[model samples]
Target: MTACKNEQLFNPDIRLATLDDLTALVALEELAFNYDRLSRRSFRRAIMSDGSVLLIAVGAQGLLGYALLHLRQGTRLARLYSLAVASFARGFGIGIRLLKACEQKAINTGKTLLRLEVSALNQVAITLYQKMDYREFGYYHAYYEDQSDAIRMQKPLRHMSVEQSSHPLPWLAQRTPFTCGPVSLQMVLSAFNPNYQATPEDELDIWREATTIFMTAGHGGCHPMGLALAAQKRGLSAKVWLSQEGPLFVDSVRDQLKKAVIERVHYSFMKQCKTEDIPVHYSVMPLAQLITAFDSGALAIILISTFRMDGKKSPHWVVMSGYDEHCILVHDPDFEEKDPNQSPLDCQYMPIARDEFEKMSRFGQRRLQATVVLRAN
Candidate 1:
């Protein structure tokens, strides 16, 4: 029950969890959830681990609630792994207080954004998160042990709302799972070329040009070089920037044949960039630099890992449609939307903190960073 020292305490009663509170935390967690409950061992590890911020809310009786925030390595994002309040003590503002405390702890640890997943059926928790300005960014099907779906959400710690620096861009949903790159390029092209009309056929055609589907395993994710080539074919100029040089996504494939095919596609796309206004550069661009490029009347399509947005770990493509001091607005092409009411809004003007983007921009073992800047010829 000791108070955290030195740091600005968000709440006097909310303090970092210690091993002594493990027994009480387990009891409170049991009363709060029926499935997906954290074990005593997990609680002990989280309390002792430097990679997480485990906070507990205390009242006169005992431990009233607890929150576990897991920080991702080499990233500025933290996952709200679990949060639970005692049933009898729920009427008080303990839940919100504890939630805010978790956010403050995350901010103290240099995390710019926080994300979590809640059961879609839990409207109470969802409403609370919404009231706190956490936006629904993604969804997971049959995610719970009880067969309940999960709603993925995120919030920027520093800025909860999009500022005046944010700009609106045309939104287009990817018709297929692996065509985000083409769809993102289409979104960018629409901003520069008024004649450009995005269609399912055109989307697929763009994907074919942007992907190395010869692997035959299934749909191959699109790469920046292919995206640049597709934009060139559409009479748009492009400059592709990469964090690393050798063929991207090679680490994603283990089969020698698959690797060779991907490498061949990579070299082929690289060779094609030799002509036209498309040029490739091997360098990591900072978030500010990217914002500057987008502000220069150029549209930038960037690569990101969906791990922070959803629970998936696949490379995703999104267009940087807007940028401001607090966050960068992205037009994500991939979406799992069942609500027509919330459709399109879920994918447009989605604000992400610059630090979060820094982590999300790189994907996989090599931490591949790719940005395709587009302009009208």
Candidate 2:
């Protein structure tokens, strides 16, 4: 495969990988990694998948190195899934050329950010990434097949500019560990109704109305149905999207009595929603649908996992204010130790890449997805 003529900024030796390069890619993967090596089947899929691009560095001696880039669907975020340089070509600048080419391809495909995960112990790669202007954001525990941790890194690219929203954001800090859901609901309620008082008293009261019996530990968390009911009781129209039919977070509880209590509470919420004629869907809602609902003057409170933001696997709630082509703007209610140096403008509207938002919008091993949409009556 020859390099695309328009993308000839680098040496003509670099080109896109095709099915003919699958054997070479697998061989290179074997030479570069001991355990998490990509198999021939995986290489074949990458070469053919529309969502990914595989580029290779070639020379007179054949394949020198390769880089795999993944463009997430419905997002401006690209991920460098794998990068490897053959042992014989390590001293040469083939790795750097491959990396630069990958970045160019990402930009050409309308990506504003490129992210990748590297093993925590890979000092050489980490140094190279740092030199390339990639910054560490977070980490994943035991992410590799060998049980090694991985450090997540991201690099921003220059692209089309997105205008920030002029609409005022409602930002409120959670009063307790288990009150993020209620706080987020308060923020949404206030956004819809200027006179809606979002005080700590209302936050706790909403928690009392929506709290589940048990979460991973400590105090209980809010249920999607309970949150919808809470909003409805406050003179708002609420709709819920929950993927599971039974009680959520039940797997986190060990005792049978506690599990039964949680189940009963969930049933009560379901019965109430039905009696009140609130819409409930027993499946995950599409991102496009959610965005459409938001554009139609509805406010959203979504549950997400905090692992990407704070390295914890707890359920969290966030208020979705607006969206553009590049990112989804949110107002997070958990402002415990927000960077003091950050300005009010920064705290008001936090921008998260669309793909990252999707990954964070689920919790637990089962990947439970829940969201509640509300609008003033």
* Total backbone clashes of candidate 2, pairs 3 or more residues apart or in separate chains: 0
**What does the lDDT come to for candidate 1?**
0.79
Q: Which stretches of candidate 1 lie over 4 Å from their true place?
A: 1-162, 214-217, 339-342
Off by over 4 Å in 2: 1-157, 163-167, 338-345
Per-candidate count of clashing residue pairs (backbone under 3 Å)? 0, 0
- Residues 86-113, candidate 2: write the lDDT tens digits: 7867756677888889999988977777
Q: TM-scores for all candidates? A: 0.59, 0.58
Pairs clashing in candidate 2? none
Say which candidate scores most in lDDT: 2
Best model per TM-score: 1
